[model samples]
Target: MDWMRDWVQAVRECEGGALGTVLCLALLFVWYCYRVGCEHASYTPESRSSPPELSSAKLRPTLGGVRTGGGASEEELNGFAYCQSPECFRCSRPGNGFNQRLYHNLQDYAKRYTWAGMGRVHKGVREQDRYRLCNRPSIQKAEVFFLPDLPSAPFFSRDAQKHDVELLERSFPALLAEFESVYRTPPPLAPGWKANSTPRGHWWTFYLVNQGTTLALNARRCPRTWRVLGQLRTFISNNVFGNACFSVISPGATITEHYGPTNVRLRCHLARLFTLDAASRGERRLRPTAGPERLH
Candidate 1:
């Protein structure tokens, strides 16, 4: 207290000694006050965040086909038309509380369970000879399908374990039953999709979900399959891209070698009714083809 009083007395004496000194002190005081006010305003809930109801209003779409609030429409903020509903898995609105948490959690999960989409080079190989080890046979007639700048692997045994494909494998009987009950007749075939290596046969596809979207009618028809699909966290469930389907390649049909559109996702194939002869391994052929493949 004595020190405080002495300091105050000294400051008082200094205030009377020079006008320039007083002006400097006054300017410092004003700056300090301004900073304090800003800090206080930043900490207040009213300044930091709006009421939930009011903030939610901004997320809602208006009559003009643009999002409201947040100082600008979504189109203006992103500089293009971007309309992902809050419910979508890929709706990455980090400003919103739920989406922010979800986005971070997904990122963490992906980091732990997935490859970061990098095409790995063989260790200890010289940079100049990198292509020598990875290249295909020169005699192959068809052009090799290549998706640029993505992790390439012949198999994904690790991804199968990460996605818990064994869980789906255990429930295969239920999935098969659902498939049987729903699709009594052969599902339609893809024409422009991929022709049979020979012109005589057809390849049919029965899809419960396609392009990260659950077909409502198909989902309703096969509840068990739908329920099982939802349990896998790493399954490509985004509305923008991904697929879950049953492909039936008929006897005497040969599907020509093809590549998937992207290399980021592991294309998993579950043999619902394949024999385990000496040539075949166990039922789980957790093959990683060149695309977004998931457990179905």
Candidate 2:
């Protein structure tokens, strides 16, 4: 009992707080070393006896040839070349089934897009605008669009006239007069628009409603225009086609070919306006603006 009491006194004199702090620091140091070792193990490379799963199994003779002088591995000796196909195995080889069909039973035709001799000409060193137009016979000759099915019984007979044309005819004269009134005091054309104009003058837009889908502005001043639009509101939703305007392109004014943000709806042009709707190979719709024309 006396020896035990002496041991306890010795420990207290040695300072137990210092001992505890040292032990805590030692533990933290060990943990940090363990974390560093784990990180080192992750980056270290390991040699595999077999190739990666993504690599092809079989190989043939390639023009790149065997490793000439160095002590190379089996993979290095087997030179690789990529044919113009995704399923190609042998690189630089004469025939690795570059144009092979996936299913033997399937029809022999261009199933999807395949690279068929593309030119790689960068304009500048950095300008890498690649254009790969599909010139496949199967793709080009495919019957894509079909005519809309119609009923034998006609909705309107030969004598039956369109109501829309009649409505336009009724409102045309009044609208024309109002347009002349608006034209008497036309707003100054936007600066950028004048430069882009083909006639070297300016193309103007008289907005009945603003481009934004809110309350109709400037439509109130033109009552006749508003009434005609109200009659057609049943056909077109106010929420959708709110922006209505009469674009006045002068005799030589030519707006460049362009596309709107969305192609959900077709633009409604009332009069003799030259319009060309062409879809690119990428399915992007290219819109041609009204060319220079004499307006009556």
Q: Which candidate is the best by lDDT?
A: 1
lDDT of 1 by residue, 3-103 (tens): 99999999988778887788899999999999777644434445334422222333444556454343344433332222244433222323345334534
Residue pairs in candidate 2 whose N, alpha carbon or C atoms collide under 3 angstroms: 81-91, 199-252
Model 2: per-residue Cα lDDT over 171-243, one tens digit each:
8667766665665553463221112222134567677753334235456556897788767622344433345
- The ten-residue window of minimal lDDT in model 2 covers 124-133
TM-score of 1: 0.41
- Over 4 Å off in model 1, which ranges? 1-151, 158-160, 188-200, 274-296
Taken over the whole model, the C-alpha lDDT of each candidate is 0.49, 0.40
Give the count of colliding residue pairs in each prediction. Answer: 1, 2
Candidate 2 TM-score, true structure as reference: 0.33
What's model 2's overall lDDT?
0.40
Position 248, candidate 2: lDDT = 65
Worst 10 residues of 1 by lDDT: 121-130
